[model samples]
Target: MTGKEEPKEVRKYLQQSHDRIFENNKKWAEEMQKKNPAFFKDLSAGQSPEYLWIGCSDSRIPAEAITGLDPGEMFIHRNIANLVCNVDLNVMAVVNYAVRHLKVKHIVVCGHYGCGGVKAAMTPKDMGLLNPWLRNIRDVYRLHQAELDKITDEAKKYDRLVELNVYEQCRNIIKTAAVQQCWAENEYPVVHGWVFGFADGLLKDLKFDHEGQLKEIQKIYDLTKDA
Candidate 1:
């Protein structure tokens, strides 16, 4: 096969699959409109979402699908492992818009059980460019090394790391200047840590209080007075 050449079945299914996807989308749109005539109209006018979701990019775990929220009800940002990297401008921009512009009341940092990202980070192998990204998770493990090292079972450690990753990302979001500023002024965007269970189709809340934790850790990371 040349640079452009491909198998016949591959080409056939590519078109057929896309055609089916569009067909499904059309039917979905019609069903939505039939249920609510103003569904698209309201969605197109402008988005005023009350929540901003930071979640993993796993296709099996969609933020909207699990939350049972309609489109435009929530502003969403998805990435590998749902990391809230302070250095990543992509998440910062989403937080900025969601907080300053949309005034979203809640921000959910959701990770899933059996996350491949968490599993990869748990191993000792170096994964090239992923090293820099995975380093964030490594840092989380290091911070909680005392607790994690105590867990004997590797599977339990992996799952525990998944929850801890979400907790760390939630803390990262709280550490941001934007979130700090908004939290000071109105406390509109409350950050949360949650884990999705693929086995049972449920989202588990880690139950870490944003304001309370902020108060406890504010001794070190608080920037409200500096601002």
Candidate 2:
């Protein structure tokens, strides 16, 4: 298809999808208002989401839809590969608000097995627009280069890298000042690492528990200060 015709074709499909979503939203809201008027009424006044989901911007894996969660249940932040870069002001602000104010109990760093962003970071190409954003994953690869190089199966190696990226991002969240402060004050908020498999539409836990991991991070920070 020609470039000019592509826009018309895309718009045709998008318009259909948009209209359906609009109808669904209206119906869902009306149903909720009827079934549980008090819940929706309080939600209208303010939101107090209990969980924060950091996920990839991949359209196929929406946090709410995948988890069957209602609005005001989970605060979310999505980027190219659900990265957790310490320097990203946008992600930092979301973390700050979710942990400090919303008082979210669980923070999930979710990556997917066949993540395009992770695949890009595995390559050596200069991604002009996404270079800075993907650098965090690249660093993860660098840190685990020795183990990654030892894996013989190419596909298995890539999968390992994807899991490692999720683990590292989960660790990164624990290092953040807001999360640390939350830990210091209350033990309610726990960070978790997850990987969504596109084939089965299932989320697999990477077994990164926040409580034990935070202690290790604190030790590292303390040792650095001592040095």
Candidate 3:
């Protein structure tokens, strides 16, 4: 051949990651099968997850792995800062399907302490299209600006914003039509707010729980007659 063979490192660089990823997948599936012969079979039949997890798109925090749950245990939807914007149809669809179809017993809005979205929202520097998405977090800060401004420590302020953002998004879920209908009919699908501490690799519930908070918000937001 006229062309010399490519260098080993160059060839490796040109190769796609499919080989390693598939190898890992094969190993993972085999391990699951070894653990339980019916694991994949049962998962393939259908997913009847009890929870719908609305979490940050950050790779470090996978909804199932961190929660000690199996693949079919939780329905998932992820976005920046785990937002539940009323304008976002993607999240609304997930919630509608989970509450109305899957009948998930819990809906979780999980944010992480070191969320890039939240940090970016707190800054004045514009992030182009991301500015619109991150503005949701900024609105949360505006709602609790007095409380947030008092926290002179920047780190503490960031953490507080993360928690507050979770609470607001969880509230958004509570305000959804599908969730209200499901709660009225099935009396299920409670909403929860939580934060993951990157340092500890633990989930800490923020206690902005739907059951208790619903009564207060019902006066304004509840659409179901009996609820």
Name the top TM-score candidate: 1
Q: Say which prediction, candidate 2 or candidate 3, comes out ahead on lDDT.
A: 3
Query: Which prediction has more favorable lDDT, 1 or 3?
Result: 3
Candidate 1 on 127-203: residue-level lDDT in tens?
Answer: 99899988999999999999999999998999999999999898888887778888899966899899999899988
Model 2, residue pairs in steric clash: none
Distance from true location, Cα of 131 in model 3, Å: 1.2
Residue-level lDDT tens digits of model 3 in 105-219: 9998999998999999999998999989999999999999999999999999999999999999988888888888888788888898999998989999888757777777788
Name the best candidate (by lDDT): 3
Please provide, for model 2 over 120-227, each residue's C-alpha lDDT reduced to its tens digit, 9 standing for 90 to 100: 988899999889888888899899999999999988988999999999988888888778777777875799999999889999999996778888888774322312
Q: How many steric clashes does model 1 contain? A: 0
Worst 10 residues of 3 by lDDT: 1-10
TM-score per candidate, in order? 0.94, 0.87, 0.91
Error of 3 at 137 (Å): 0.5
TM-score, prediction 1: 0.94
Clashes of each: 0, 0, 0
Q: What RMSD, rounded to one decimal, does every model reach?
A: 2.7, 3.2, 4.3
